[model samples]
Target: MEEKQIIIRGRSYPLFRCHTLIVGSGAAALNCAYHLVSFGVRDILVVTERLGGGVSNNSGSDKQTYYKLSLFGEGQDSVYDMARTLFNGGAMHGDIALIEATLSAQEFYHLAQIGVPFPHNAFGGYVGYKTDHDPKQRATSAGPWTSNQMYQKLLIQVRQQGTEILDGFEVISLLTVGEGEQKRAVGAIAIDKNKASSGLDSLVVFQAENVVLGTGGPGGLYQTSVYPKDHLGSTGVALEAGAAALNLTEWQYGLASIKFRWNVSGTYQQVIPRYISTAADGSDEREFLNESFPSFGKMGTAIFLKGYQWPFDPRKIENYGSSYIDLLVYQETVVKGRRVFLDFRRNPAWKGGAELRFEELESEAYDYLHKSAVLFGTPYERLQKMNPMAIQLYAQHGIDLAQEPLEIAVCAQHCNGGLLGNIWWESNVKHLFPIGEVNGTHGVYRPGGTALNSGQVGGYRAAQYIAECYRESTVTAESFLELAGPALERSVGLAEGALGRVASPNGRIWLEFREELQARMSRMAAHIRDAAQIERALAEAQAQWEAIHRFEFRLEDPARLIEYFRDRQLCLTQLAVLHSIHAYLQRQGGSRGSYLVVDPQGSASLEQLGPEWRFRPENAELRQWVLQYQFDSRTHHTAWEAVRPVPEDHFWFENVWRSYVNKEVFRDSADSR
Candidate 1:
């Protein structure tokens, strides 16, 4: 790596030049850097706002899973079988699924080899179990902090390789060259959070041959979210820099504790805690679920199913399914304006009498509890017996689940869709690879813990592609300086406008905008959707975006300028996502993934929920295509494209050897669009 200074707005700012620049410090970014060094491409620099603030390090659930090919089991498995399983999840492209499947073992073993500690038996077999949407037992875990373990181990490997990482730098722009289809990603521009008060010292620029974006999801887009608060994500920069996003309408929303921002999945739900709600002043406490569900057995079964059927899937809403519980919670909290809680301190009150009837419970719920020897106690006792780590985890966060009720909301947890990436994880912009949650590879319904596997596989593939095809910087120092000039000027302009402002009542403008956008998203575009409201919300988002450029916020502290830019980017992301939702609705898209499309003319999800709960069933044919959007210069262009089919490779030994040796294997650019 080389460093210099470039004059922007009559001030000298630091300029860096490297072969590859990584824009995050999560498990995927670390894994990419580690593999780049192993692949003999060592000129790398990783820039992150903070080292340990990402979701991979800070967020988890009960027994967070890591899905891969079934490594050791009596059931037979193959690469195609896994690929088909992933592809059948709807809206997923087959080629990308195939690559992920084919590399599952390699990446899984890589983590295990680097000390992730995915458990194995005495016979040295990495065992597996079933996860949501699984046809076979292909899920495994070390503990609740599975991704955290992966991040730690990968960080060790990257540090051992002497890779340079810049902490406290938040990337705000992707520096590009050329125009139209000829445009290429040359590098990026980031702000120094620690030095933002200073004029020239506040900005840093990188000129690299290739850029790996592992910035996770747009976690800050919604008010109700389980994503770590500090991990706001840099995807808006990529989207602004000519990257296309796919399936932006698909997201995973589930019940999660709000105060500490932890997923209330797995054993947390299997323990069958009591569901209650209270008024704003903690008055009017009532059992919300008991009133909605017809019988105790049905309610207990639904609660138990929430352990595995964690994500609120529209398909799981009928017949008093597990996701029906999510709707009830949503109604209690969002619709009725009350606070909901999971009370593990005592058993749910039985309308049938004081004594609970274990015999009357659903077989799945009864058998699982009976087999585990936890059928004879209260929810807290059952939790302590089944998974003590669940209680200990909350206790660590100062929320004693054993002593008090846990507040929860149906919150946005993951985006199954994001910036579009091809089989090798390269985005529409040449030399820019979006790995991890930023990459839209999962489609609609991914198996639990598959995100971790996808991130690992994406990093490996991006690194391999970079090592083979994008090893050298074609643009020279002077040329890079020339290409980065426009982006730098814009950054300087924004900074100039934001810095050294007088303290005013409007100083909280950014905060107000944040609250407005987050609330709008949580209410209008989350688990429930109304097409008319979404259209209006899109217009409001656009107006706010325009307001941003009009200097709506005055910053008393220049340090707050970082947040200014972050929210500025977030505004654009939110706009793009809303636009995507509107476009999908315009295309007659309905409730399919995690969200529901409420159509008054359609049937009610449940007759008792009233006409407002009416939602249209999914248009099954839409699953054959993917929704893609590109935002450029305030223009939103969205279209539907047929899903890419899985490729059939003939493994003729001699021909494969020839392609591998001559580097023809890396020459396929079919899906780079």
Candidate 2:
């Protein structure tokens, strides 16, 4: 790799040339860097806004799971079986599913080998348990910090391998060349937060043959989001660079604590804490669930089931299923304008002061509580008995489960869709790979903890493809300048214009824009959706997207320029997501995945909710096609492609060995950008 300086708008900015430029420092991004070094590809650079600030290091549930191939006492399990399960999830490419299934064990072992501390039996067998949407018992966990441990272990490996890391840089634009099939990712332009206070000199450029985008999901799009505060995603820049998005409408929304921004899943709900609501001024508190549910047993059962069925699935709403609790919470916080809280200090109160008799509860809930020996205590006591770590975790963040109520909301947790990638995790743009949550590998439905597995598999696949096929760059310094010149000029112009604008000292322009965008997304594009609201939101998003480009900013602090760029990225991402949702509604798409599509002529209805909450069932046939959306800097385009079927090819050992030795395994991967 070589370092130089490039002048943009009379300000000299740093530039580096490398074989690969990784645009994040999360677990997946670090894993890619480690694998690149192990594969003998050393000319790589990693850029991130901050180390250990993304979701991988900062988010978890009560018992964070890690999905992988069953390695021990299994009734039966195979790569083909796992592939079929992932493929059947709907709107997922069969080949990509096969790749992920095939690599699950390898990635799992890599984590375990690098001190992830996954529990094992005395016989050295890794036991597994069932998770949501999983047929086989293929989920495992170390504790509540499974992904955080993975991030820490992988960071050690990456640092040990001497991979160059550049922190405090936020990517603003991807450098690309050509158009259509010939298009390719050259590098990226980033805003140096540390140097932004020095004005236009903050812009830095990277010239590389391949760019690995491991940035996480679009977490900034919603006001009520569970993603970590520091990890606002950079997916908008890739979309602006013409990366097609797939299944953008599929997202996971669930209950999470707002104060500490942690998931309140697993034992937190299994303990059956009291659900209460209060007036805006914190008075008039009452047990809200008791008024809606028919009996203590039914309500208790629903709350217990929420431990595992955490995500808000429309299918689970009828008959007071686990997700009904999600709807009730949504009703209280969003619809009724009340503050909802989980009172762990006491068990839920039944109508007429009827006690919650464990034996009278549903067998599933009853058996689990009986097996865990937690049938005789308050919710916090039961939680302390089952998992004291859940309590300590909150204590670490200044929240005590035993002392006070925990405020929560039905918030956006994860996106099941993102930039479309191939079997090797390469996007349509040649040389650009989107791994981790940024890559749309998961579909309408996925097993719990599958995102972690997919991120590792994607990093391994992307690294191998880069090392074997794209080992060096062909662009010299002169050619690199020609390619990145226009994009550089546009970014500098935006920065200059924003800095020159005048505003009052109290005006936090970025915060104003961010709140407006997040509020609109949470209202119109969250778990509950209506066609009319989506259409209106789409129009409003477009106007805001345009407004962000020309919005004035106070030069009171140039170091705050990263916020302006982040706001722009978030605005574009919100616009693209709205376009996707509007397109889905136009196609007569209905309630599916993690969200509900409300319609006036719908066939389904919730018991306690009004006609306005009536929703249409999913269109079964739509599951056979993946929704591909693109925004080419002007108009939003939508296309549908049939789901690729699982591969049925017979593999001959000798033939496979020949292909492996000849380096033909990556036949579809690009050798140059």
Candidate 3:
């Protein structure tokens, strides 16, 4: 074939090589970049396919219920709460020191000042509550697009710091120097912004001493994914760079992605099956849905079967501490000849919202008034003006959720385990720092809403560390050009490889492989696991590796996708998965949140509905909602008989009282307090 090469800027550029290269631009990547800049390190180059949110765009989980609220518990959740949650949430083997010390709570607050809007409660207050393992309510956020919002703000900060952003560029590998002993990461190899490799541009030699690998996780390896991100921009690249791929095989089943082929792709095209709710007495209520599926068929099937139908606590339903939907619940349904459903029409919320025709307002004042009206026992019509997604889903779909139950299921979502690294976001290898969905800072089943917080925290921490650590390194134009050379050559070869002979075989086979993988992974990696299942999964993953090696591939980008799959396979190796799975199983103490001991038949304890809340039911007409709640402090502690009592031993009464208030948090998350 004739040469398809070109020169640019008076220089013949090769593909690979660069100094201070970042692989992803998601929350993790952006956060790290910003944090790196904050550290006073300037020779930063961020190479990514996009500059927006991470995996969150695909997260269809109901976001109306916020994470931060006026929660009054033991510690009143703060930056400290994040550390506690990570420890309690089975990140026992994680780099707790980094999390404990580095995550940026102030940075999260700063995002708000940067124009990211946080949802206000009816009283126009910054709403917050104890969600899952978070102590107090420090998890302030800006709607469901927290990741997107954070990414936007962080991107602005990154650019302002004078770092060059190469968007849509594919990073092919890490550029190392010295033979072996003197081996160090000076930079990375990447294609130009167009993602072309006909000839390398800016090849090999963006020279800088400290390189950080912020490549993302390995979720794309599965046949189905919440991430429509193509271009082989995943942990596979980190692994290919020989970063000792630790805990890679220990792939955490992200919020189970559904199996579906959207008319479109990427997170924006995500569609969820409607899920309905009914009163505790089976007196049907409205349906509410926010959860998104990476896949539909599988997720729909899981939900059709209904919860392990775990009941919500009447008293603390908002917190829903013990009401975690078990992964095994769906697995059992499948194993027992039953399948989950993706029903939407039956959910109760849709019908009521359809009947109401109310649109929620975005202001804080109305929210407080709505609650005030509820405090005085106002009519239902006034409450719904604040809740719009519910109404829109109903009116738009014309499906009365009250009359019918909405179908729902759990599919894979985010990657809890990614390319392993230190708390600083650096992979085992030098210079490359894997961040966001690609970084495996978390183990399996990350607590709800933690990804945003963690990414922000990790980014800030990594940047600060890099700046302080590499204050002596030089980052200049000439040095960068020097590092760009080798990378150019590598990019050209890989781009050619992408277009060479390869076959994906049948998409059907790929689907089956994914299903089998899920089944194996779920059993071995679910809420409660056993040694046998872990070993079994290890064996199966090993076999799959061999099979994938034999599988055909097309020499297009999907070929890189094939390589991506292998990256996930390497991640699934026994070392990664077994260590954490076994670690989770090994912790032989109390179980809270999602973890529960399965009976021999997989039946576990159903928790009691502890308390009841005075709710202001939403109604039609006003189209603007308000919320006002009045509760006697004396009544806050409902039958929390099992909770420990506050000690009068020379301590702040509130802190002491929270021990009694958040008994479950202390007991459940252990470290959150």
Candidate 4:
């Protein structure tokens, strides 16, 4: 590594040079750095706000799963079969799906070897189970902390590899060179939070051959989110730098506890807690589920099914599945302006003031409770009987589930779409790669834990590609300086302008803008969307963005400055999401996957009425299309791209033959044959 000094506005900053610069500190970024070292690539630098700050380390539910092909099942399962399942999951591209599936088993085993304690049987086979949208039993876990375990081990591996990490440095801009097809990532501009906090300006530049983005998802963009509060992803920065984003309209939303910010699926739902809604003063309590479902059995069955069907899906509404519960909760909270809670102390009251009993549940629900030996107790006791850790986990977080009702709501869980990339995880901008939640790998609906697998696979692929193509020697001082010049100037100007802005009495604070953005996005874009609502959201988001420039901030407080930058990024992401949704609605694309476009007129129940109903089957298409968005200098553009099907050569036989010929039978076969 080499360091050069540059003068910016009478202040000198250090320009560090590296082979690769990764902008995140989660599982994906650590995995990419580890693989880069394993492939003999040195001089890698990882810049992040904090180590172990992303969702991978901080968020999980009871039994968080890692989805992959079944290694030990009753019948034979191939990678092709897994690929087919992934391809048909939602509106995903077949090539990316196949790539993820093919590498899944290898990545799973690699994690196991490197110390992920995936549960095993007495005969030494990995135990598996079913997940949402998964046809086979391919999901496995090491309790609720599966992703955290992966992150810890990979963090150790990354440290052992001697990768340089600059913590508390926020990357604000990506520096690119050339025009159109010739454009390539040269480096990035980052601000040191520690220095800024001490009243010393420290703007550092990293001159690198490659930049990998694994900054997780835009968790800060939503008011109601399961993502960590500080995980402000770099998707907006990439988009502003002319990187294309795919399927921004598609996202996953589910019920989660607001106080602890944890998912309330799996064991939380399986143990049939009472769904209660109350007014502002905590009076006029109502057993909402009893009113929504036809009978106590139906409500109980839906609660049990919610363990598997965690995310909200429109199709599930018609099938009497659990997603309808999400709709009912949403209508209660958002539509009727009330608060919803999950009480586990007792059974819910029926319509006629009759107490709901365990005997009233359907066979599927009752049998599971009987099998688990939890049939004769309250929901809290049943949860203890089934998974004692579920109760204890929340207790550690200061929420005693047994003693109190957990405050919960339908919140944004994951982004199915992000920075658009191919099988290699490289963005359209050369030398810039996005992995983990920052990369839009999943389409509309993804099987649970697919995000974890996608991050691993993406990291492996990106590292391999970078090792083979970009090297430290390829990045010259002149080239980096040339590319970074304009970006540096632009960033400095923005900072100076922020410092010079006059405080206005009417100007909105970052928190105010953030709350407004979250409220609008949650109402319009989360589970239900329509053209008119989306159009209004776009206009509102744009107006907010414009208004943000007029706001003032204290130049001495670095945290406030970072929040200002984050506000811009969040607003950009919101606008992109709105644009993508507007385009999809314009094409008359009906509700598919997590994105539900409501049909106003054709529903029977309260859950199916209003803006939450689905379009008729006769008017919808079987095949799905992905929406792409790009921001240029003057305008933002969006278009729809039809998903590509799996190629004929992707068959099992062809893959097996290619592997055998390439590695075993014929060495250097491309020349020999």
Candidate 5:
């Protein structure tokens, strides 16, 4: 390794050289760094905007789960069953599901060994519970902070392994070299947030042989999002570097507290709160769910079911499940021009002025409430009895859920799609790997806690692959400088152009543009989707992006520079999402997962709801295809690829024979012969 430095604005910035550079400070990045050191790869650097500030460390709810196959269940349970369940979720690749399922248990136990406090029963068996889209009880928890616990433990391990972490350094761009199959990721350009904010020109260039992106999802891009407001992810950078994105239209949206931005799910929903809608001025109060459901018991049971059925799905709309509650809430709030709230102060009342009866509720809902000892009180009292921490957690964030009704709405929770990758987590750009939320491992729907598991699994796989395959490869300073020259020029030119525009009196600020972009996305691309609206949004977004380039910036304010770059990245990502949605609608791809395409004929009539409430299903044949969005830098145009399924033969005997024929089984004997 050689020392390289660059002079900028009369200040010298060091260009740190390393074997591997991991972007992000969350569980996935930490785990990857730890595993890399364990594999004897030194000179590792972990760069992040903030330490312990990612969704994994900052977000939680009532008993957050880490989903994996049962470690001590009945002998009938197997990884193949888990894989099938995952694959059947639609829009997911079979091979990816099988790989994640096979590695789930190993990653789960590894986290536990690293000091994650997974609960075990007296019989020395790990207890498990069911989660969304899961057929088996394969989900377990370490209280609500399951991911945070994983992050803390992994952070400790990474520190102990002597890996250097550059906190507050946000990676702005990925540097790549060569062309086509010979192209490879060599390094990245980063800016220091603290120094930039303090009016200092501080930038660090990292030259590495391998780069792992664990920077999570595009949270800041959404106006109504559960992700922390400051979570600036790397998906945009990857896309700009010509990496293909998978299933950009698929995402998870659910009801969360408006004030705290925390998911009001599980026990918070199971207790059956009174859903009230009011005007923005706090007038015109009405019990909204009662208007939507035919009976109090139906609405109450749906609320109870929301504990597991969190994300809104059109398929679950008329299925007598809690997900319909989300549709109703969205209709009431976004469509009908009303504000919604979850009032736990009292039990829900029937339209006929009858008191709620326990027997009238569904059997499962009644049993869950009974087992939790929440059978006979107001929703607030029941919530306190069931999970007191839920109320207290909100209080810590300056919202008293117990005293006041929590304002709620359908907000973006998780992105199921991201940078496309193989089983090793490597993206199209060689030497560049994406892990955690940035890796598009999950498809249309996923079980709760699978994101955390996927992050760990991806980190482990990427680490092993890098160590086994690229440890001996040389990444010289001269080669890195040569490869990074064009990217560097582009970044510098963009910055200089922005600085030049700052002299104009009518130039817009980055914040105003960001807010406008978020508002437009929330209106068109978030939960509800229509062809006209999405196409309009794409056009507007393109205009906004073009307008953003004309914005002026103060050279002294480094924060503005960071925001400028982030906003640009977000605009590109938003365009990708909207274009994907537009193409899907054009191809007659119907609503699956979190995607809800509006029906033209207005088929739905939930209490005579408007056209926005009407949803139509896609053709059944479309389920066999996955839509891929790729940016072609050569033509400066976006291209779409339909990934159709290939024939798969999964017979057990055939698999064994194939393994033998490939010399995977009894490899030593076959090699000797």
Candidate 6:
């Protein structure tokens, strides 16, 4: 392992070359190079350090897409009943697919005839509204930063469609070709983060035949989230250069609420996607019958397509309705514990507006309206008359999202499986291609605004399937440098010195094993999880991935060798979210997404506890009857629920189509000073 003959501008290269590059600049790599320069392919290239930081980069990138209604073979109402009532309010995924939840309004009127603006009124038309994963009313946004105002307007139509952005460039490996059935994928070996001479060369290694990752997700391993900071993890550097990443076991988590003197980049991402609350003793309207309502799984997959069933329990809403009971019922009036006001004094959405119960709209900008009328006690002459972006983000960074009930928690967004493919996104290697949030085409549990409608229909279907694999590849570039020139000379001879320094104890045992895997995923799969905290977070994620294979950054310092490729991608994406929260914590009979659930006569032993369960029955019921027929039909949930797919005795797949169903897109990240 020692091949480093570098050289760039003066020629002498060949560390890796496959071609079609594209790491990410968000909106699934600028709508996969504006659908590979509108299907003509004017030289496609897109590196990244910036550009909508993944998972609908907060939602802009030319007003993303997601409107429902397809009917896939007249299944009538079912991406599992719009994921159990408008997006997994009760953990959805029962092999979700009724033809990708009925082709989301033909991919939202084809991304509003491609340019995306979206916001229209005063007779301009098209505002349909109604979100929670559609039944009709549809979805569209441009204001409140619809994914950063449709990615600045698609990075100015991707630098006026010439395509070649670059930004910071990091990528490091993947350059394979030929060995096992003539392996494929040609170029990639980059680094340049501003390299010396600045002609971009901190170790220039360029070679390409085909590669596209749209690197996003893995949410900075986690500590807290709302994203928008710097979001690194380059899809764990393209699954440590081998690819394969399917639903690295569903890592999504949400708690994004914050108020106690507002901090997380001041007032949550741009007001929790667009606000609401009615509390004051109504406990934000009895937290939909006292807590247990957390389900943004694809705009709430139409509350299970409107039938709604949910009854399980994870301590019935953090034990009786919480965010502290929507801050003591709606907008204030606690008394000794402090939330005060007895009158919303003519409620502008709990008196501030984020559309109180979805649109009635009024309070246009009262920046925490005098600390939410001084924490609901009101009267300081209505807090110097109406507060404005909470008195200018509290006077810039002083934070006060309405008086003070904001300290939300939930973390780890994104990484809903990665690599692996079929429905045209490609990946078992070969010409490669991973479209948006490192493509796993939303496997485990993403259902809200479907990662800006699967990076606008998987970057316009990986730009018409890498332009029909480059008009049917006859293959060249010296047969992709004699097929990825010996896997880029054995990944630059496993990088010479083989890099060193493992113990940071494997990055402090992956940050105390991601804080005990976010307290065993807020307790075996939050929102409510069971089967003994999903067999004790899958036996503490197999002892936190055997201490992340005793980490040792294979030596090198591109910022601690990309945290040694994010400590083996947060231990293989936390062993794919502890084996998909031990298959929804051994579901006895119910649950498929929001935070694991399943128990009803399925003893799920490890201590057993089913009466209806408030929590405690162990080993998540025989690992949900051994992954419902062990990945029944070879998984991607029976190929995104088009069911009946996995039938070729054991591996090497054949027919798996599944596109974006009741889309639960959380693929997010962010950073700041």
lDDT of each: 0.88, 0.88, 0.42, 0.81, 0.79, 0.44
Q: How are the candidates ranked when ordered by TM-score, highest leading? A: 1, 2, 4, 5, 3, 6
Local error of candidate 5 at 358, Å?
1.8
- Supply the TM-score for candidate 3: 0.60
Candidate 1, 1-673: lDDT as tens digits:
9999888878888889899999999999999999999999989999998998999999889999999999997899998999999989999999898888999999999999989989999999999999999999999999889999999999999999999999999998888888877788898888888897764478888889999999999999999999997777777889889999999999999999999999999988888888889997899998878787788888888999999999999889888899998999988888889999999988887663563567778999899888989877888998998999888988999998878899999999999999998889998888899999999998888898889999999999999999988886699998776777887788778777866453656645678888899999999999999999998898899888887887777766666778778888899899888988998898888898898899988755568787678898898888889999998876989999998877677679998899889888889553544
* lDDT tens per residue, model 6, 1-673: 1124444334454243323667777766776777677778766677775555544545221122344443223225434454333223222222223224444555555555565666556765555544433454445555334565456567777788877776766666666655433555666765555652322225446555567777766554444444443464555445544555443444444334323221122122212222233443424321221123333321222121211111112222332222222222221222222222211122222222232232221232222332344323322223334323233433344544345333333434455556555555666566667776666555433444566666566666566667754544355544545555566565444433223342222344333444655445544454445565567666766676555554422332433443333445555554554555454433433433333354555433212122453333333222122221111111213111221221223322232112122121111100000
Residue 250 lDDT in candidate 5 = 86
Question: Each model's TM-score, in the order given?
Answer: 0.98, 0.97, 0.60, 0.93, 0.93, 0.31
Q: What is the lDDT of residue 251 in candidate 5?
A: 92
lDDT (tens digit, per residue) of candidate 2 on 1-673: 7899888878888898899999998889999999999999998999998888898999899999998889999479998998999999898888888888899999999999999999999999999999999999999998999999999999999999889999988898899988998889999988888887776678888889999999999999999999997778988989999988899988999999998898899999999898999988999899988888888889999999999999999999999899998888998988889999999998777874965678778999999999999989899999999999999999999998889999999999999999988888898998999999999998899999999999999999999999988886677788887877887788788887777653446444777778988999998899999999998998888887777665643535677677778888898888878888888888899998999998988988874777787789999898898888888888789888898888876878998899889887678333311
- Candidate 4 clashing pairs? none
Quote the positional error of residue 591 for candidate 5 in Å. Answer: 1.4
Error of 1 at 338 (Å): 0.6
Off by over 4 Å in 2: 502-508, 552-556, 668-673
Worst 10 residues of 3 by lDDT: 633-642
Candidate 6 local Cα displacement, residue 401, angstroms:
16
What lDDT would candidate 2 get against the real structure?
0.88
